[model samples]
Target: MAWNEPGGGNNKGPKDPWGGGDQGPPDLDEALQKLQEKLGGIFGGKSGSGGSGGGGGPAFSAPLLGVLALGAAVVWGLMGFYQIDEQERAVVLRFGKYLETVQPGLQWNPPLVDEVIKVNTTKVRAASFREIMLTQDENIVEVNMSVQYVINDPDKFVLKVRDPEISLQHAAQSALRHVVGDTGMDLVLTEGRAKIASDVQTRLQEYLNLYETGILVSKVNVDDSKPPSQVQAAFDDVIKAREDEERVKNEAQAYANGIVPEARGGAQRQIEEANAYKEQVIANAQGEADRFSKLLAEYRKAPEVTRERLYLDAIQNVYGNTSKVMVDVEGGNNMMYLPLDKLAEQSQQRAVRAPSLDSNTLREITNMVTEQLRRDAAASGSTSRRGGR
Candidate 1:
């Protein structure tokens, strides 16, 4: 029989056999009522009252309470232990005071007593700043820059300053402005941007170190540095003019490089030509002098024959241009038709007299005279025939 079923208890059995006399069965309600009265009296409450005001209400009460306490403890322990990622660091604070720092992986702290703030110390942090300042030359210029950093010391990061990020930003701005103010505009725009970034980074690091912020600056980059937009056009014009000047200078140098060598080569060629002409002239003059000396020696050996040969050569040189007739003018008007006066003038200029005639000279002169008469007779015959016609 089941425990909750009706008449399922020990009273359901037959009446006791040991008692042969009339032993009646006990009343089930009376038995239950006396048992309830005894239990109620033991717990210091009224019998048959089903209220929670009675004490010692159920069995295993202490054990249940113990089990509940154990569960609560387990939950609290679970809440105390936490894990930090590889890129994070935990800053523990005990009762509003710094306690210790925890590295990555599973960590434990007392619950409700200690607070852990996990900061990504390994993550690279970046900040940008911009400003305008007067240079050493009293020109105002604007500079924009960025800085990348990481937290290397968690203790100093949590304890040193109220807000490390804000402090670092301010420090960076102050350093940049200070550096820009100390330099000139030309340097800032051209060669000094790198130097400026370096200087600002150095100053920022110094300030951060002084403040114990534990931020390590990794890189400083100069984004843009220039004159203000209002004067930007004027600055551009200046830069353009400078570039134009450089280009013009380079072009002039290129032209010189091209032309100078050609000019030099031409000059050298002319000089060589002149030198060759001088050498030819010198050689011709030397040859003429040697020939004249040889002629003078030959002339001294035979004066008459040399004079005759020279006269013949002179006559050939003078009369080589045209036909000419030579006549003796000692007899007056021997050849009236011929121009004797002009012939005499030419002979005086030549400084040579006609040869005197002897027997042999006379025969040669007679032959020359006979040939001239025959040529004159033929010319007169042709003229007479043309005139008759």
Candidate 2:
């Protein structure tokens, strides 16, 4: 039965394992002394000498505590082994103080004595949010944006900030607000989203660097921006109106481009025509002046002959254009006239109508008329000579 149960074994009084003599438990000091000796013998230590100077309890437990401590240290060291991927970096700290940053690979550090923080240096991380903010035009706009980043320095990322991602989130919000607040509502909701995103990225990176967050911002994207639902229709109408205005301006510019060149060409053509007319007038005037100058030189050599030649030339020119000629005899009261053009016309008509009028007969008739004119001129010249004598 049980060691403390009564009336169970051999019909004897209950036995005490501690060697009690009066059916009660043994003395605390004496039992403890015996137990210490037994444990000392088991651990290969000498038992107490039963004197004041010999104690085996401390000696027996010393080696056991050392072995336990060594085992704990070995477990702690094993716990420190960590594998880092190719894209990660590790930051090590010893005794709560900054140590060295380790590259990606298998790494180990003493547990409880050194701290290790692993960060993915080449992996891009993303943070995104949607918020409402006021614009420069005092209009409220809802902005949806995302920020992409990577850990540039693992040491700074782990050590310089209490929470790097939280800090990045706050910095991103601040930068987005600053950019949106400085822009007008039309730009925020329309074509200026790219510019705003670029500005937010630049400002956010600056803030992260200043705070030593070690977050390198890869890109910032303004996904969507618009007025609240209550004013969305009105904003759409405004955008359409602006687009129409731009289209009208472009059409007017195209029309002007088409018409302006044609008008300029017409004007240039008129100018060229005027210049050609001016050159023609100048050439005619110069030719007339040169002819008059040469005639004046010939007149200086023989005044009377030049005067008579000029008169005859004028008469010849006048007669050459007419069909009739008038001749006045010097001493006779009669004037002679000849219709030579009428005669030539009658002869050509007769030659066409009558087959009896040959070319030879027409030629002989013309020779007779020429002889009579020559004789009349000779008679007039002889009469003039007699009158002069």
Give me the runs in candidate 1 sitting further than 4 Å from their true place. Answer: 1-65, 260-389
Error of 1 at 46 (Å): 12
Tens-digit per-residue lDDT, 142-230, candidate 2: 99999999998888898889999999999999999999999998889889999999999999999999999988999999999988999
Cα lDDT tens digits, model 1, 1-389, are: 44323342355444454642334466665565567667657755454444333433332246665888999999999999999999999999999899889989999998999999988888898998888888989988888899999999988998889999999998998888888888988899887889988998899999999999989999999999989999999999988998899899999999999999999999999999999999999999999999889889999998899899989999888866544555433323344245546765865665556554458865886689679866775666676667668
How far in Å is the alpha carbon of 22 misplaced in model 1? 58
Each prediction's TM-score versus the true structure: 0.54, 0.62
Clashes of each: 0, 0
- Cα deviation in Å at residue 317, candidate 2? 10
Clashes (candidate 1): 0
- Deviation (Å) of 303 in candidate 1: 16
